[model samples]
Target: MSMYCNQCEQTAKGIACTTHGVCGKDPEVSALQDLLVHAVMGLSLYAVEGRKKGITDPEVDRFTVKAIFTTLTNVDFDPARFQNYINEAVAMRDKLKERVGVSFDHNSANFQPASDVAGLTEQGKQVSLDSDKETDADIQSMQQILLYGVKGVAAYADHAAILNQTDEKVYAFIQEAMAALTRNDLEANDWLGLILKCGEMNFRAMELLDAGNTGTYGHPTPTAVPLGHKKGKAIVVSGHDLKDLEELLKQTEGKGIYVYTHGEMLPTHGYPELKKYSHFYGHYGTAWQNQQKEFANFPGAILMTTNCIQKPQESYADNIFTTGLVGWPGVHHVDGHDYGPVIEKALAMPGFPSDEDNGTVNVGFARNAVIGVAPKVIEAVKGGAIKHFFLVGGCDGAKPGRNYYADLVEQAPKDTVILTLACGKFRFFDKDLGDIGGIPRLLDVGQCNDAYSAIQIALALANAFDCDVNELPLTLILSWYEQKAVAILLTLLHLGIKNIFIGPSLPAFITPNVLNVLVENYNLRPISTPEKDLEMILG
Candidate 1:
C-alpha cells in the first residue's frame, strides 16, 4: 500500500483507503500530512514542557492547533501547502526546543526531516498510521481515537481563537495529549483515561467556540431562510466561518451582488449582525456531499471558508475560491481578512437570472432562543403535547445508508421535536415537520461548531423538568463522518451520555475490544432502522 487513510466515514471498502483517499486525497499529499502530524507532535513535546515552566507562547499554541487541523479530512489536499507546513512545524519545534532546554529520547522528539518534499514524504511513510505494527491493536485504536479527537479540538480552538476567544487550559491539554502519544509507557487503561480526557477538553474547546461565535455575531435568533435564489449577481459562501462570511457580506453591500449561505453556513443567516445585510440571501444547496452537483449549477462565485471542499468539477472549478485553512491545488486562495477578489469574481459572473421562491427552512433555534421560550416548552412537555425530543445530526457524507436519517426524521411522530445541527441536517432540512403547541418541530441549532448550544438546550430541559438529562424523554440519533464528529462523540461520553444511537456505520478504526469498551461503558448502539430504533427508544 502506498498510502492509508480512514479518517472519514466513506473510507473505501468499509475499511481503509490504501492507495488514495476516498475523499480524493492522493498518496503524496497523504504522506506530507502524516509528516506534518509527526512534526506537530514534536512541537507539542516542547510545548508541554514549556507549560510546566509557566511559559507559554501564544504563537506556538495557535500554530500547533492550526497545523493539526490541516490534517483533518477534506481540509487540505495541496502537497506544496503541506510541504510548507512541514518545514514550519520543524522550525517551530526546534525554536521551542531551544527555549525549553530539555531533550527527550523518543523518536518524535528527536526526529529530523530531510529538507525536501520527497525526503519528507519518505520520512512520513515511516511514521504513518500503520508504522507501529508492534503495538496492541486495541491500544492502537485508542491512539487513533485520541489523535482524531485532538484534530477536532484543534479545528474548534482555531475557530475560537480567530474570534479572540482563547483559553490556555485548552491549549495545555492539546499539547499534553499530543505529547502523551509519544510515550511508550502508558498501558491500555492509561490510554482509555486519556481518551476520555480528550473528550473533557473538547467540551471546553466547544464552550469557548460558542462564546466566541455568540459574542461576535450575537445569539442566533429563529429566522427563515429561502431555499431559492433572487435575480442578481451573487456569491455563495460555504463551510463554517462566520467571520469570513461577515467580511464578504460587508464588502458586497450595495454592489448588486447577493450573498447566499451553503452547507453549514445556513445558520449564519440567523445572526443579527449578518442578517442585517439586505443582499445576504438564502441557502443554495444541501450537504457538502452534494456540492459537486449543487456548485456546478450555482451561477455565482463560491467561497469555501473552511473544510468540506470536494475536488471541484471542471465546470465550476474556475468559479470557486478557498479561504482560511481549506485548500486544493490550482484553486485560488483568499486571505480571510479580505473579500475583494471574491467580490470581483461575483461581479464578473452571471448570478441568478430570475427570482425563484422555492420556499424556506427555519434555523437559529440555538440555546438562547430555545431557553428564552422555556416556559412554554416546559408546559408543552408537562402536558404531553411534546412526547419526546430527538437530537439528530452529525457530519453528512456521500455514502449509502445515509437515507436512514431522512427516513427516521420522516417517520418520527408529530408530537416529537427534532433538534439538528451540522451538515447532516441537510438530510431532512426542507421537510415540513410542522409544530408542537406552537413550537416548530424541526429546530436548526446552527453548525457543528454550535454543538455546545444543543447541549445547553438539553440541560435546560432537564433542569426545568427536575430530572437528570438521561431521564428526560430525549434521544440522540447521530450520524458521523469525520474527526469533528468523533470529538463530539467523545464529548458526549465524557458528559456520561448513554444510549446514543449512531450510524450509518461505526468508525473503521475501532477494534472489537475497543468497541466493547464503548458499548459496556456508554451503552452506545448502532442504528438499525429508524422504525425499529424509534420503537425501542419510545418503548
Candidate 2:
C-alpha cells in the first residue's frame, strides 16, 4: 500500500516496487513521485490548451522537463522536493490558463492536490498508468511504453536544458503526450503510432543534447583515460553531467586535488576543453552500479552528479555529495554549481598515496570523431576488412542477467567492429579487442545520451554504402535499465531501423499483446544467449 513503481528495468522482483524502490527510493518518496506525476499530467492538460492559444511559457516548459525527470528512478528521493514541484506545476498550469484568457470546465484544469502527506497519498491513489477503466490490456501496455518513453525524454532533455538547450517542440510533445495518457479514446493502433512519434521527438531531444554537450565542451575526441588514481587529494565525480564535472575540475585547479571521473563521467575526459585540465587525473571506477563497493574502498570524496546513486554507506557517507537534479535525503547538494564544499571534503580526505598501473580504457568516439575518419572506415568496409558493425550500448545495472552484453562482445566475430556508448560499455571496454587496420575493433561512442553519435555514425555509413541503415551490416543489442535507455530505444525505432535484439529482458510494462505488435512489426526480440543472438544477427 505504500507505493507502486516499476518504471525502471531493474524493478524489485522484476515487478513493482511496493514498500521500497530498488534504487533506494523510500515509500514516501515513491508515493510523492506518483502524486507529482499525477499533478503534472493535470498541468499538461492546461499547458496543451494554452499552447493552442499561442500562450507558452519557457519556464513551464523547462519545469515540465525537470519535474518529471526528478521522479525517475535513482534520480531523486525527497518527498519535500516533490511537494514543492507539484505545487509549482499546478501554479504554472493555472497561470498559463490565465495567460491565454480562456476558461473551461475540465476537471484537470481545476485539479488541486492536498499539501500534506496523507492528502497527497489519497490524491495519488486516484492515478494509475492507464486511467481508462475500459482500456484493453494491449492498448494499456502501449500507453505505459509511451508514458515511460516520455519520462525518458524528460531525463535527457533536462540534462540538455541544464546546458542551456531547450526545445519548445520537445516541451509541447511532453505535455501533449502526458495529457494523452489520461485520454480514454486511443486504441491499440493509435497508441502504437504515438510511440513512434514519441521516438521522433526523442531523436530531436537527443540531438539537442548532443549539440549542447559538444557546443559546451567541444566534440569529444578519442583519448585514453587512465583507470588508476594519482597520489594526492582526489574527488571522484560520477553520473552523466559534464558541466558539473568541468566546474568541479575548474574549482579544484591548483588546490592540490586530483579530479577523477567515475561512471558515465569517464567520457568527459575525452572532451578537448575538459581534457586540457592538468589536475584532471583519470577515471576512478567501473560503472554506476558498482559504486557502493568501489566508493567504499576509495580514499577520497565522491560527488554524484545524477542518477543511479544508492544509499551511501556510513563508511563514506560523510564524503558523498549530489548535484543538479540528483538527490539523497541527507547528502550535501552542490548549489549554484559551486563545488567548494566537495573540494574541501576532498582536501580533508586521504587520497591515493601511490599510483598504480591499473591500465586504461579509451573513449570519445562520438560522431565528430567517428565521421572524421569516415573515409578510412568506408574504405575498410568496401575492402571487406570490416563485415559487420554492432552497436551494444545502454545503462548498466546490478542484474545477473546483464552479463549478456559482456558475453556478446567477447563472442563477436573478429571481422566485426563493436561500437558502444553509455555506462554499459564498462562490461568489456578494456578487453583490448585490438585493431582492424589501425581502427580499434571496439569504439566507445561517448555516454548514453551520446547514442546520438552512434545514430549519426550509422546514418553516415549507410549513406556511404548507398543503402538504408538497416540494409548495412549493423545490429543493435540495446541493454536498457532506465528511462534514458527507453528514450534511446524509441529513437532507434523512430529511425525505422529494425531487427533490434534487446535484453536482459523487455520492459515489464509491455503486455504480451503489445509485445507481439513490436515483434511482428519491428522484429524486436528478447535477448537469449549471446551465442544464439549473435548467430542470428551475424549469419
Candidate 3:
C-alpha cells in the first residue's frame, strides 16, 4: 500500500490502498513482486558464492540482471507476468545453489493457487510489514539507500544486457547490496558504505555498457540526423539502444524505409559506424513524457528499446514495438537482441510519403569524438570563444514543472555550451539553438549513465586549465525521474562535485533532513523560473 511502500517514488501518502497500488498494481501483486526481489537476492548470493569458488557461468549473471529489471517501475505492471518472473527467479536460485554445492530449502516456498485471487488478496493483506523488527530510522535509511541503489544497478544492467555486456563484479555487487538490505544487524555507517559502494559499482556497470556499445558499434562521432519525414515507410527507434537501431538500420537499408532516433536513442547519430547508414534519420519528438501526443499521428512504427515507455495510446498502439526490458501488456515484444519482428512491422506499416518532409536534427559529441576536438576546444576557451559550460541533463518525468528545463536552455547565455545526456535533453533538444565556432552549442553526451562522459569532459577541461573541476566554469543542471539518476547523482556527490541545480521537484522518498544535508554540503538547489535561475547561474 502507498502508506507502507517506501519503494516507489509515486507512493500515495498515508495509505497506498491495502487492496491495490496507485500504479494499478494490486496488493497481492506487490507482495509477489517483493517475493520476486527476495528470490533474486538469494540467487545473487548464490552467484557470489559461485564466483568465490571460481565456478563462473553466464546464466548466473543473466538471471541476476533479469530479476532486478523485472521489478522496475511499470515494467511488470501485470501481476500474472510478475508471478512468472518470481517462478523463474526461484528456479534460477535453485539452479545456482545446486551448481555451487549449496542446497536451497524448498520449505521456504510460498506459492499461491492460480484460481484463488480473492484468497491471495486476503493473504496479501495479512502480510506483515516487517518479518524482523529492526525499524530504526537510520537502519531504514540504509536499507532504503541500498534498495534504491540496486534498482539503479538493475537499470544499468538492463542497458548493458541490451549491448550484450555482462560483468560478474557488477552483478555480484547488486546481489551483495540486496542481501545487505535484507540484513537487520548492519549499522548505519555500514549501509552508507554500501550505498557509496553501490555508486561505485554503477560506475563500473556504466563503463561496461559504454565499452559494449562503442566496442560493438563504434565510437560516436558528430553527424547530422534528419528530423523531417522522407518518402516511403519509416520506423522510429526510441529509448536507449544503439545496437537495436543499428540492426534495424541494416535491415531497412535501401528498403525505402527511414529510421529515426527518439528520446535517449537520439545520441546514436554520433556513432561513426551507425551514422554511416544512409537510411538512419534524425530524432523525432522530445522526451519520453511527450510520447503519447507525439506518437498520435506518427506515420511510422515506433520501437522502444528500454525504459521511459509510457502507456501507449490507442492511436499509436498498433505501431509501437518493445524490446529488451521494456514491456507494455499488449504491445509486441522483440526480445533477445532480436529486431526481426520490429523490422517486419516497420516494413508493413504505411510510411510517410516521398513528397512529405519534416526537418533535420544534428546529434553526436560523445567523449571519444569530443576529446578528438579537445585541442580546438582548448584553443576556443583560451580565445574566449567558449565561456561557461552547462551540463543540462538527467531523466524526464510526468511532472509539470519540467518545462523549467526548456526555459533554462532557452535562457542559457550565447557564449555557453550545453552538454546534455539521457532523456532530460528532450526539453530543449528539438530547438534550433545554432552553433558557435564550428560546434553546436548543445551537445548530447549519451544516456543518463553516460554522465561519465560529462564528468570526463569536465575533468578534461579542468585539466586543460590546471584547476580543480569545481573551479571550471561548468555547472550541472540535472532533472531526475528514477533510481538511475539517483545513483548518478550520488556518484557526483561522492566525487565532491558541487553547485548542482536539481529539480523539477525533489524525490518524494527523500526525507527533509536527508535533503538538508545534501543542500548544505553540495549546494544543490531546486530549479526556479528560467529568468531567475539563469540570472543566478550566470551572475
Candidate 4:
C-alpha cells in the first residue's frame, strides 16, 4: 500500500482513500504519483550534474515543469497515465546521463526507500528498505513541504517562460531542490532550511511572472468587463497565461469569433494590450473548480492555458482545448504559441450564432493598477465609504466544507471589499455582491501565486492609513489545497504577517506541534462556520 502512495499530503496514519483525498486525489492514483516524483528527482539530479560540465539546455526546464506539474492535485488522477510520465522522465534522465558521460548505480546500498519495511517490502518488488535506518516523520514532512513548494515555483517559472521570461537561476534552484529530496544524509534542519529557501525562490519566481505578464501585456488596469452577452461566434480562454490568450485574441481577430476571459483569465481584461481587443468578451465562470458544471452549456469552445483543469465530461470534451503545461488524456493540446489546433477546434465546435449575446465581466486590479487608485481608495476609507478589506483567496477544491468560502463572501458586511487571487474565487465570483462606493465588492487578482499582489496592496493600504498591516482594516481568510499556498504562507510568515484564518481544515501533514507553533506565533486559526468567522473578522 505504501509503495504506490507516497505523495505529499498523503495519509500518515494510513493510505488516503477517504471517499477521496482531502485534495481530491484517490489511493491507486497516489502511488503512480510517488513514482512520478521519484523519477523527477532522478532527472533533476542528472540535469544538475550535466550543467556542471558546460551543458546548457532548455529541455531541463521543460522536463522539470512537466514532472512537477504531474504531481499537482486534480491535474493527473490516473495511475497508469502517471506511470507513462515517469517512464518519460526516466528516458530523459538516461539521455542526459549519456550526453554528460556520467553513470549512476541504481543498486547502490545508498538508495533509501521512501516508505517503511511493510510498505517497501512488497511481495515481488526488488527495492529494499535500509535495515539500519528509520526515516523520521518530521524530516519527511519538511522535505515534502520543500519539494511541493518547488513544484509551485516550477509552475510559475513555466508561466513566465511562456511570456519570454526565463531565469536560469530559478531553474537551477529547482534542480538543486529536487536533487536534495533524494539524499537521505540530510538532517531535519537542512530540510527546514531548504523549505525556507523554497519560499525565497518562489518569491523570485513570482517576480519573474509579474514582470513577464506586465511587460508583455502592459500593466493590468481597472476595467469593467461586460457581463452581458453580445452577438457573435466566440471562444472563451481560461487559466493563467496572458501570452497565449493574447495570441489567441490576435489569431481570432476579425474572424467573427469574439474572445472572453474565464477564471484567472479575467485579470487579462485589465491589461491595456489585451483589453484593446474589441472582441474580447467578459468573464464566463467563477473559478477553476466550477469548470465541469460551468462549461456544461457554454456556447463557445474553451481554451485552458494552464492548471486548474478539471477532468472534462464527454459532453464538452470535444470543445475543450489545452495549451502550455496543461494536458488531459484525450484533450487536444495546442503546443507553443501555434494555437492552430485550438483555432481549428473552435471553428469546428457549435459556436454561438452571429446574433447570440456574448457576456461581459469586470476585471483588472493588479498591483500597479490598484496602486494607481490608492488615493481614491484611501479617500474612501477616510470618507467611511469602505470600512474593511478582506483578502478571501487561495486555491479551490471539491471538499464539502469548501462551500464555507462562498457563504462567507455572501455574508460579509456590505461595507467591506473582497480582494481575491488564484482559483478560490469561483465560488461567489458570479454573485451580485454589489459595490462599496464605485468599486465592485469582489476583485479578481489573477492566479494563486498572485497572493503577492494582495500582500502589496495590503501593505500599501497600511502605509496610507498610517499603521501596520495588522492594525489596518484588513483580514486574510485563506483556503489552501496545494503547495503554492504553502510557499505563499511561508512568505507571509517571513514578512511577519499574522492573524490569518485558514481552512476548511488544517493540513493533514502538519503535526500537532507544528500547528501549535504556527497558531501561537501567527494566531492562525482553522476556519469555522461562516457566520462565526465573518463576525470575528467584521466585529
Off by over 4 Å in 2: 101-107, 130-134
* Reference-based TM-score of each model: 0.99, 0.97, 0.88, 0.84
Candidate 4 lDDT score relative to the true structure = 0.72
Candidate 3: global Cα-lDDT?
A: 0.73
**Could you give candidate 1's per-residue lDDT for residues 203-281 as a string of tens digits?**
9999999998999889999999999999989999899998999888888889999999899999999999899999988
Per-residue lDDT tens digits for candidate 4, residues 1-539, read 33332233333343334344544465445555655666677777777788899786687677787678767665655444565665577777777878888766543212333333234223113321211146676666676667767778877777777777788888888888988866789986687677767777777778888888788878777777766555666688887777888889889888777787777776777889888888887777667777889888777788887666777888889888877666676787777688666667666766655444344445677788678888988888899999888888887776668889999888888888988887777787667788877777888776785766777888888888889888988889998877778778776766778889987777665666667767897898999999988788777
Model 2 lDDT per residue over 129-153, tens place: 6344677778777887888899889
lDDT of each: 0.91, 0.85, 0.73, 0.72
Record all residue pairs in model 3 with backbone atoms less than 3 Å apart, i.e. clashing: 2-16, 3-16, 221-270, 226-282, 227-360, 228-358, 228-359, 231-353, 231-354, 233-351
Name the 10 consecutive residues with the lowest summed lDDT in model 4: 123-132
| Candidate 1 runs further than 4 Å off | none
lDDT for each residue of candidate 3 in 1-539, tens digit (9 for 90 to 100) = 42144454444552233445544455666665666666666666677678789877677677667777766665555556665666676677777678889643322222332344444333443332333354775466556656766787878877787777877778778877865554557776687778778878877778777888888878877776666767778788877767777778877888878887777887778887887888876677777767889988778888887666777899888888888666767888886657777667777878876654566656667888788888988888889988888899988766568788888888888888888888887777778877788878888788786777777788888888899988988889988766778778777777778989988776655556666767898888888888888788778
Of 1 and 4, the candidate ranking higher by lDDT: 1
* Backbone clash count for every predicted candidate, in the order shown: 0, 0, 10, 17
Error of 1 at 137 (Å): 0.2
For candidate 1, the TM-score is 0.99
